[model samples]
Target: MKRWYVWLGAAVSLVFLYFALRGLQLQQVWAGVRTANYWWLVPGVAVYFLAVWARTWRWHYLLRPVQRVSLRNLFPILVIGYMGNNVYPARAGEVIRAYVLKRRERVDMSPSLATIVVERIFDGVVMLFFVFVALPFTPLPEWMRRTVVLSSALFFGLLLAFFILAASPRQARAVYVWAVGRFVPEAWRPRVTAVLDRFMDGLGCLRSGRDVAMVFVTSVAIWLTETVKYWFVMHGFGFSVPFYVLMLMAAVVNLATTLPSSPGYVGTFDGPGIAILAAFGVQAALAASYTLVLHAALWFPITALGVYYMWHERVSWSDFGAAERARRSEPEVVGTEMRDARQREVR
Candidate 1:
């Protein structure tokens, strides 16, 4: 049922994107594309690759205390995961990633997934920080202030929830069990409870001050690199946007991806990118052009590289789909239990 909903949502998003693009004038878009400094795109692409490498390092670093995996082993998997996100909806790339690491590094999927969840929290907090810092510098409209305020409040609320859960495993476990008990069959309750118990164990990595500091630093660096990439793309298009404005734009673009959308964030990402740029005083046509170019800069190369790596790893789209299916079929307890076990081991 969940998988069906994801596919249905993805289909609708894709149809919307197709129509959105069709509505735009081909000549105008071509003119924008033609104006692009193709050479500048090269460096933009390199910066994007570097950003991915940094992100993979951060992910590997977070997993280090529990399981020591080399960056070399993780980077390709990370790229493949991002590729999955572009092609699949509901961000199944995350589960695909946990599955890959589980297969390649003997890492249990649940704990690994817990770390990913933690990483996402860090990413959100950092992005929100950037948005807050950059807010005054950008020429945000009065109407948009409410949107920013609402988003920031929600983001911090989530962060607070993560911190509370991380600090109190028993409480989290109780909540998890309660939620599971509401729907899971009585016959399977014991097994489900055992699985969730292990999953809660994975949250223990946050107990270390050193680990927390390292993860925070890495999260900042990753987002900063992303900001630089966004700036570079704008520069490539001869736009004179400030660094902080680009940072806010980057935050907006990241937030946009969190929305339900088609493969590669098609209309969803582009629309937000253009709107954010326009908020910063960029012209509509140029903003649209810049958004498309930036989208290509970030999405196209990694996707192509992901395909190559997937082939090299001998994993087909069907294989990935099957793995996703397998993951979905597992009782949530399986993941929760494994995570709890890993957290206990880490602590």
Candidate 2:
């Protein structure tokens, strides 16, 4: 299934690349890239790291209910996790990051995974918020609007479900039993339920309205900082869009990254960004060049930093595989006693 996901992502990226490149002059795109002032990228990259720091703080806040991890300690783990996402398929970096947290902070994996899920959902909500904020001024194409609507349904739906799960455990369990109980074998049900309970523990922050608001506020700040990078990079390429348009582009491209794509989000990020610019009246070649450079600017520095942190932390490439195995083994480890008790009862 993992291998299948990798291939599917590659194929999806190829499709996006085709559209991104279609009818564009390759030479003009290269020319635009070659002539751009590179100095703007310095500040762009700097602002991006600030956003990463904010992200670490957000994760730190979310994990506090389960375990109080220091932001200084969490930063490198967050960077390494992002690096893993850039290089690995299926956002496996999420699992790897959670595993690293376990190794470093002695936090349980399921709850950490739950916290990560909360981060993703909030991020999606923020991205969609950007889109709507820009909609009136930016005049997005119909397809983009439709995409936002669908994504809104998904992210909001998830937020509601998680709120229900975290706020009302008994109700959640009853719903789970009604929906999924029969499918799970009696021997495995105890383990599954226990793992889910731990996962819900990760969502403890959501039970408090203030914490949820803080998460949303911090999420908004993160993306706004990232959109600043987009604005800076836009200056480098010698064409300019309004700040809100940059916000729209940032939101659209990042949302596009949520689609299946090759490592580093490849064509998925570039295509939507280019399309957004083109729709906004920028020349296709200029949009392509700017989007390509912006994509690299966004991808490389943090990824390199992540690698350095991985080395400093003594984590290796093999650790990613280990993380995957660890995640799969969590249920077995947590459920062992329950499973044995059921067996004893049967005997």
Candidate 3:
């Protein structure tokens, strides 16, 4: 099943890549790549890491109500997870990160993963802000505009439903048990219910408006800081698109990557980005070149840093394999809350 899914994702990736690279302008693409200020990447990478640091800080806030892990401790786990995401499919790195926390910090896997879900949800909301805020400036195709609006409604609906459930664990508990019980084998209900209890406990932070607000603010900071990286990268190409436009690209592209795609988000990351920049009057070759380099910048530095930390922490491929196995066995308390991706992104 996993191999089948990976192959399917690869097919989707090829389709997106074809769109991203359709025009035969290798000369222009190479010209764009060669006559560039490579030095801009220095600050681009730095700003990217800063955004990641803010993510760590926000995760710290989320995990505090659960087990109180320190940012220092969580940061590497976060990077490792990001690294895993880059190399693996289905963003399995998230699962690996939770597994690592359980191993290193003695945190329970279910709740730790729940915190990641919360992270993704807040990320979705923040990225939506970026999209809606910049919408008036970018004249997207009608199809693209409708896609964004529909997606916004879907994300808002999901968050609202999740908020209501997290805010009322008793009702959530009943709903979960009753819903799952209707399908699960009779003997499995008790174990599933127990997992639901732990999962709800993980969402304890949601009971406070302040905590949600903090998560939202930190999420904005993280994306905006990363947007600064996008801004910096644009300088390399001598393209001076407005910062908000870049934010919109960052928002749309990263959100697109959350969909199933090849490892490292190959086509998924580059395609929408190229399309968006093209819509903004960037020539196709230049847009493709810019998007490709940006993808490399996004995929490489943190991935290398993650590998460094993985080696330092004595984590191995075996550990990676172990994490996948652990995922198959982890309990899903609430069907999609603890089960489905709250969503995804790095920009």
Candidate 4:
């Protein structure tokens, strides 16, 4: 079953790859790649790490109501999680990140997972912000326009629901149980409800309106840093796209990557990025060249950093692999036990 998803993801990626490379002159792409000055990537990569640091900062803020972990510690874990996403399928890096946090910081897996969910929601909302702002300026395809509108509505709706749930936790819990009880199997509801409560407990920070605002601002800043990285990389290829265009490209491409694709989001990341750039009037081959190189820059640097930090932390590949398997194989009983163990630690 899992293998099927992998095959399916690989298939989807191939389709996107074909579309991205279709009608493009490879010689031109090669020429673009060969003649480009690589120095700009240095600053691009540096600023990318800064964005990662901002991501770590955001995670730190989220984890505060749970446990206060330092940036030094959290950065690597975040990188490791990203590494997992890059290397593994199904974006299992998320679970791997929660697992690592549980082992190192003794944070509860459920709550740690909750913070990750919140982080994703925040990121999605900000990406939509970029899309809407850029939408008015670009002549996107009909499909792309519909995608942006649907995605915007979806994320905004989720954000509204999240705020409502956070504002009324007690009532939300009742509603959650009632909903879960109606749908979830009788044998599973007890364990499910217990885990759900702990997950909600992790969102304690969201109960404060100020914290929500800070998370939003930090998320926007993080993406802006990412946009600047894109701008720097485009200079290498002479893209000459305005910053807002890159900003929109950053938003659309990153959000597009949330789809199922090969590890590192190969085609899912590149196709839309190139497409968006093309939509903004970049030549097809030039856009392909820029997007391909940009994807490599995004992939290689952070992965190497994750590997370095993995070694620094004495976390072996065997450990990482084991954690991946553990995540895949972890049963409901184990999840409940993990949450119970966390509750005990908190007590």
Candidate 2 clashing pairs, residues 3+ apart or interchain: none
Model 2 ranges with Cα > 4 A deviation: 177-181, 337-347
lDDT of 1 by residue, 246-333 (tens): 7887887787677777668877777667777766777666777888888887888998999999988877777677667655555554
State how far residue 146 of model 3 sits from its true place (Å): 1.6
lDDT of each: 0.77, 0.91, 0.85, 0.86
Show model 1 residue runs off by greater than 4 Å. 1-26, 174-183, 332-347
- Global Cα RMSD, each model: 4.4, 2.5, 6.8, 3.0
Each model's number of backbone clashes?
13, 0, 0, 0
RMSD score of candidate 4 (Å): 3.0
Models 1 onward score TM values of 0.86, 0.95, 0.93, 0.92
Model 1's TM-score against the true structure: 0.86
Error of 3 at 275 (Å): 1.2
Model 3, position 190, has a per-residue lDDT of 62
Model 2 / residue 147 / CA error / Å:
1.7
Give the per-residue lDDT digits (tens) of candidate 2, residues 1-347.
28888999999999999999999999999999999999999999999999999999999999989999999999999999999999987788899999999999989899999999999999999999988888779766677678789999999999999998889978887877665577888777777877887898899999999999999999999999999999998999999888998888888888888888899998999998899899888999999999999999988998899999999999999999999999988888889866688899999
Total backbone collisions, model 3? 0
Which candidate should be chosen as best, given TM-score against the real structure? 2
